[model samples]
Target: MTTPQALVLGIVQALTEFLPVSSSAHLVIMQDYLGFKNPLLLFDVILHAATLGALLVYFRKDIGKIILSLVRLKEKSDEEMLNRKIFYFILVGTIPTLALGLVLNQWIKAMFTSVTFTSLMLLVTGALLWISKRRADSERGIEEMKTTDAFLIGIMQGVAIIPGISRSGATMSTGLLRGIKKELAFRYSFLLSIPAIIGALGLQLREALLEQTLPSHPFPWIGGVLAAAIIGYISLVLFRKIILRKKLHIFAYYCWTIGTISLIIRLAT
Candidate 1:
C-alpha cells in the first residue's frame, strides 16, 4: 500500500476499533472500493498490535490491581475480594466468546468479503445501539456483577465476530440491557476485549508466518502502526466520555446512515 493509503487505513482502524462502529466493516469497504492491498497480512497484524498496545497502556492501572489482587487472593477485605471477582469475571466472559468464535470462524471469515451482507449487519448494530438508549437507569457496580452477566455479554461479543457488528457496541449494549451501570459496562466491555484481541492477533500472526509474505517497504507499515495506536487511545478516551454522558445512542444515527448508503451502493452495483 502507498503511505497515504496506509495512514488512512490506520486512522480508520483506530477510530472505529473502540467506538460503537465496526472497524472490520470500514476496512473491508476501503479495500474493496479503493483497491488497497497489504500482502502477507503484515499491515493487519501491525495495526492490531498497535491497538492492543493502546488498550494495555490505557488499562495499565486496572491490570496492575487485578494482578495484585490475584497474588493476594486470600485477603479478607471487600475491595480485595471484589478485585479478585472482577479478574475471574473476565475469564468467565472469555469462555463463551472463544467457543462461539471457534465454531463460527469460517462463517465469520466469509462475511468479511461481502459488503452487502456487512451493510445489513450494520443495520442490526444500529438497532442494538438505539435500544440501549431506552434501558432504565442502572447503578449496579462490579461488586454485584454475576458470572451469568459476563457470559451473556461474552455471547454478544462472540456474535460480533460477524463483519459490521460492532464488538464494543454489542457487548456494552448487552451489559446495559442487563441493568449494568453505564460506567462499569463501558469499562468491562473494553477489558473483555483484551483476550479476544490477543487471540485474534495470535491467529493472524500464525497465518502471516505460514504465508511468509513480507513487505518490500516497511516504513509505511510502521507509520500505520503508530497511527493506529495513537488514534486508538484517543478513541477509547472519547468513547468513555460519551458512554458516561448517556449519549451512546448518538452513534446509532451514524451507523444507520452509513448502512443505508452502503446498501444502496451495493444494490446499484
Candidate 2:
C-alpha cells in the first residue's frame, strides 16, 4: 500500500474508534473499497492499544478512586461503600459479555462477512438508540441499581459484538433502558469499553504475532498509533457531552441515513 493509503486507513480507524459507528465494520468496508487483502493485523492491534491507552489516560482519576475504594471494601466503610458497590457493578456488568465473547468469537467473525449484514446491523443500532432514548426515564442514578440490573446490561453488551453494533452505544442503551441517567449511563459504558477492548486486543495481538506474514514499516505504524490515541481522547469527551445533553435519537438518524445510503450505493454500483 502507498503511504497515502496507510494514512487514510489510520484516519478511518481513529475517527470510528470512538464514534458510535463500529470501527471494524468501517475498516472492513474501506478495505474492500481499496481492494486490499491480507491486511497486517499487527496494525489493528496497535490502533486498539492506542485507543485503550487514551481511555485509561482520560479516566485516570476516576479509575484511581474506584481502585482504592474497592481495596477498602473489607472495612465496609460507609463512604467507601458506595464506590465499592459501583466497582462490583462494573465487574458483574462485564461478565456476560466476556463469557459470550469467548464462546462465539470465531463464529461471530464469520457472520460479519456480508456487507449487507453489517449495514443492517447499523440500522438495528440506530433503532435501538431511538427506542432507548424515548423509552428511558433518564432520571435514575447509580445508587438505585441492583446486581441483577448490571447482569442484564452485560447481556446487552454481549449482543453488541455483531458487526455495526456499537459497543458503547449498546451498553449505554442498556443503562438508559434500566432507568439510569444519561451521563452516568454514558460513564459506565465508557468504563466497560476499557475491559472489553483490553481483552480483544490481547487476543488479537497474540494471533497477529503468531500468524503475521507481511512486515509493515515502522513509521506509518507509529504515526497511526499516535494519531489514533489523540483522536480517540477527543472523541470520548466530545461525544460524551453530546450524549448527556442532547437526545441520542439524532445519532440514530445519522446511522440510518448513512447505512441506507451505503446500501443503495453498493447495490447501484
Q: Score residue 183 of candidate 2 by CA lDDT.
A: 75
lDDT of 2 by residue, 54-105 (tens): 8899889778888998677676776577677777888998899899888879
Off by more than 4 A, model 1? 37-40
Candidate 1 lDDT, 1-269, residue by residue in tens: 78888888899889989999888888877777766543325567778889999999999988888889888868878878877888788999999999999998888766777889988888999999999998737677897888899999999999998989999999999999888999899889989999999998888788777776667888888888899999999999999999988888888998899888998998998
Q: Which stretches of candidate 2 lie over 4 Å from their true place?
A: 74-79, 135-137, 213-216
Q: In model 2, how large is the Cα lDDT of residue 138?
A: 76
As a TM-score, model 1 comes out at 0.96
Error of 1 at 158 (Å): 0.7
Alpha carbon lDDT at 30, candidate 2: 74
Clashing pairs in 1: none
Positional deviation of residue 226's Cα in model 1 after best superposition, in angstroms: 0.5
Indicate which candidate wins on TM-score. 1
